[model samples]
Target: MSDATLMLSGIEKSYNRGTPGEVSVLRGVDLSVQRGEVVALVAPSGAGKSTLLHIAGLLDVADTGRVEIAGQDLTDLSDTRRTATRRADVGFIYQFHHLLPEFSALENIVLPQLAHGVPRAQAQTRAQDLLDRVGIAARADHRPAALSGGEQQRVAFCRALANEPKLLLADEPTGNLDPETSDQVFAALMDLVRGTGLSALIATHNMELAARMDRQIRLEAGQLIPLGGAQRPA
Candidate 1:
């Protein structure tokens, strides 16, 4: 196994594998993100970028190949062990904030840490610190509906990082906002990732945003290929 914070070797995934309508998504994909590295995953609609992210984040299983997080290969773990590993080693953000409408921003962030066995007081402290990191601490008591779009997404970033996962998988985290708001929210995310020295694989269609990362990889024909210049077959 490699020493990457997240790594995938020969990863493959298919839907309805034995059926006539079977579709392959990721095919023999290989990638890795080291500590403090931020990589952009670029793909057009229906390119299976999210599917790859799900497998990397441990939210879905691959049909073959290996997935390693923080140097531990997870392809052979039982469901119970996978769940525990996911809870402890991965953080995910989506295009939507997906914040609990009924809970305050602080509560949304605190809940994940609490579920991960952090004491309530410590969880609350961590949540508050995260809020402050994203410049949303002043709005910590607000519900999702009460915050602006950028603020809401900032809160979502905090929630994703609450458990201090070594790898963060974000799917178009700023895609829902206007360009101005997207920039702000993306900056906040970058700050948090850099501050914590976490590795991130962020899937985005926005080229401008992708260029801001440490490196860029494009998903084409069911495989990850480097962006720009000569490319690999799917």
Candidate 2:
């Protein structure tokens, strides 16, 4: 088995296949994310970074290729098994926090764990610990509507890591925040990721933010190209 935490080989995906409106989003893309490595995926709005992330996270399947997570080839797994693997081994963060408005920050973080069969008390403990790590433990009881944008996003981060997944996939996680808040939240995220030793593939339009990760790869014309310097246009 490969030592990589996440691997994608010959990945291909297209929409409206065989039609004039068809758009190819990815083409024979290959990547490997090793354990504890943080990779920055740099791309503009129209680039296929989201599609690649979805495939890598098992939220969507590639038209052709192999996807391996922690040495397990999950490309052909059944939907149920895929769901299980996703729940057990992958965590995702998006541009928006997407926290449950009706639930408290702590509850929002605890729900996924409950769904995964973690006991309520244990899940709550883990949720609080995550909130503490992100420096938001004081806001644990507040609902999303009552929190600031940065606070809400921090809760979302806790929710994502509630399961302690082996791999993290984030798509413009700080895009909605202002620069100062983005930087603070991003630092918390990096700390959490590094502290737990999880592999990560984070997509970002900000070159400064991308440069902070361990390595950077730009998605252009449906293919990934390694970037030695972070000055490339996203």
Candidate 3:
């Protein structure tokens, strides 16, 4: 039982580890998130932002170091246990809003909970509540094909939060939206997650969005550089 909601220490990831094409993404990266803070992760393309995020979410394994979520060390867990930990403790929002095409927004939001063994009736109630809170109750019946891009993203946000996870990991969540729409979606997300004090680490190329976070850290040459600090030598 640690105080950190999410923690990563000396994380490293390398592709083609022993071959000529080997590429290392993370080099001893360390990050920590507590209770209800929003930390912005900023990095350019090929700086391994997505790779680092996947490793943090337990969606991918790091080459070295440790990842702990809600104080439980994942390195020693079995695959099944890891999967369960991810399902219960981590909530993920991707740029594309990966909702099921056939399911209505309500159904999409409730499905994850059902998979985790929550009864259908209880999950439905929770889904409805989330939709309302996110200002999408009116759009709950709209399928992906029927909803606007913003509405679809709203539903995706609701789905991510259905399980009340401690850590919320978002990757370029607003990248696909128009500036105005992106603002709306992000505002809704802040409102919904802020009250709960969910620890969040979001990666985005947009400085405007990054400015809204508590701390902004940039990645360069396999390392994190503090934003607004003196420029490091090339």
TM-score to true structure, per model: 0.95, 0.96, 0.94
Look at candidate 1 and tell me the lDDT of residue 122: 98
* C-alpha RMSD in Å of predicted model 1 compared with the true structure: 4.0
Residues 119-211, candidate 2: write the lDDT tens digits: 999999999999999999999999999999999988998899999999999999999999999999999999999888899999999898889
Work out how many backbone clashes candidate 3 has.
1
The regions of model 1 sitting more than 4 angstroms off are 228-234
Worst 10 residues of 3 by lDDT: 225-234
Report lDDT per candidate.
Answer: 0.91, 0.93, 0.87
Model 2, residue 182: what's the lDDT?
A: 96
lDDT of 1 by residue, 31-101 (tens): 98888788999999999999999989888999999999988889999999999999998899999999999
Candidate 3's displacement at residue 68, Å, is 0.9
Candidate 3 wrongly placed segments (more than 4 Å)? 228-234
Question: How are the candidates ranked when ordered by lDDT, highest leading?
Answer: 2, 1, 3
Worst 10 residues of 2 by lDDT: 225-234
